[model samples]
Target: MLDDATLRQLSKTRGQTLERLRGVFNAGVGGDRIENMLYRLIGNKDGSRDLQGLAEVLQGRNVKLWVVSAGTNNLQKKKGLVDADVDKMRLLLDTLLKISSRTTKMLFSGLTYRTDIGDQLVDEANEKVCLLIMAMNQEFGYARIEYLPPVADLDKGQHLADHVHLNERGYQMWAEILAPRVMELYGS
Candidate 1:
């Protein structure tokens, strides 16, 4: 139901209806909020971290902090758990550390919950992700690597806008959960 093909088909079928209601009930009326939410809804780690400018940006001496908070969609794609998935993540982490400046401090948060993945599997998969973080921390001991456990409670409907992407309150709550860690590393 949450696949790209499905979304494209829905857009095709519903395009006329959306156009008809554009003046009265347009999502873009407010901003790109709805459009951004939809993109994040289908955001999976199919081939994440293309690393287009990763090395270039982090190579700078002033690039001190790298806060990475993503990977819930990996679970949607049945990733971040299996052996192959672990291998790929580890490689990415390793590359990230290697390409980054020596002084770069990384705060890597674990996976958040997806409505599609059951709670049990989410926990287990996030545990695997945590292990990868730990391994990267061990290997890249020169730089600080802080790992926070998975973001919880997203399965609860209040935080979700469409049982998929987070709403305003949901994003605020996520920021609240990470504010302390960000402040700790980033300072006031």
Candidate 2:
């Protein structure tokens, strides 16, 4: 999750004031999957109590950058439907791109390794995610959409406590890695 403190720190580091806009609907629902997100986006389901959909949130707003971090929950699903997941992800990205302005920069965070899950399953899911990133970059072009790599040492236990979620130090490290790229894009 992109915390407020990290965004504030990023603003200070970049010497540019940045506003945080959030549109989260379902929170802490283990059953939340990519299909659910797609349905929410299409107005089939209520995405949030306030924000209707992702495009609706962006509509009439001054958005310069969009960062999306999803697919982990989808990958964690028991039934492995990598292709379906990737297709849904592509549709989401395409929808976002259509709704976003031409100058809006987009960043897609890649899947991180989960230690709590089976090693082979995690590896396979990450591989599919990497492929999805590659395909998205090719379709969107490198200049418009960028793929942020997973944290280098997720297995080291210093950053992650549950192996699924990040601890305070992990969040700090994530901010450190993400803020600079955001700054660079803002500057450009």
Candidate 3:
């Protein structure tokens, strides 16, 4: 793996600002010295917070269904997806699946399309996300990991505030999508 200074120089050489490099990368892009360039550029996240979030869910409460959604914002940062990103994503979801009761249903939705960033970037990220979720379902051999592809026919500029966040209408639309599935696992 390239050292931080080396990556910093590489970033500078490429004229890519650290702020803009928040998405993803792999050794494949940089050859030998770069192993998961995303982690280096973004700073090692350590995933403590991710683990903590899961821990909180495990505390006393009964959670029959875990509705998980994330990754679009950072995914918007970089131009390409990498294998390390996929590995990290798999590890995170794998932990949840392994620890949670087998009967528990997990519903993970693909990243949303964004007009804030180029739709191309978000759309690309969304595809990687969709693929990872599918892979996780297959690899974990769990029948309960349900995936909802992003909605069709939703007006992004209208439904999203700042073309990224959910406006009131967006929230309603999202709820409509989630409700039936939630009811399926959670009941009335």
> Which prediction has the highest TM-score against the true structure?
2
**lDDT digits (tens) for residues 5-57 of candidate 1:** 32233234421221221111111112222223234322344576432333443
TM-score of 1: 0.62
Tell me how candidate 1 scores on lDDT.
0.51
Largest lDDT belongs to which candidate? 2
User: Tens digit of lDDT per residue, candidate 2, span 1-188?
Assistant: 23344344444543344454354222223335667666666553454554466566656555566676667767654544377787888887777677767787777766655665565665676677667667766776666677787676665467665756666666556666776776677556
Clashing pairs in 1: none
Reference-based TM-score of each model: 0.62, 0.69, 0.63
Q: How far is candidate 2 from the true structure (C-alpha RMSD, Å)?
A: 5.5
Clash counts per candidate, in order, are 0, 0, 0
Q: What is candidate 3's lDDT per residue for 71-142, written digit by digit as tens?
A: 554553557445666566666566555656667677776666777566677667667777777776777676
Return whichever of 1 and 2 wins on TM-score.
2
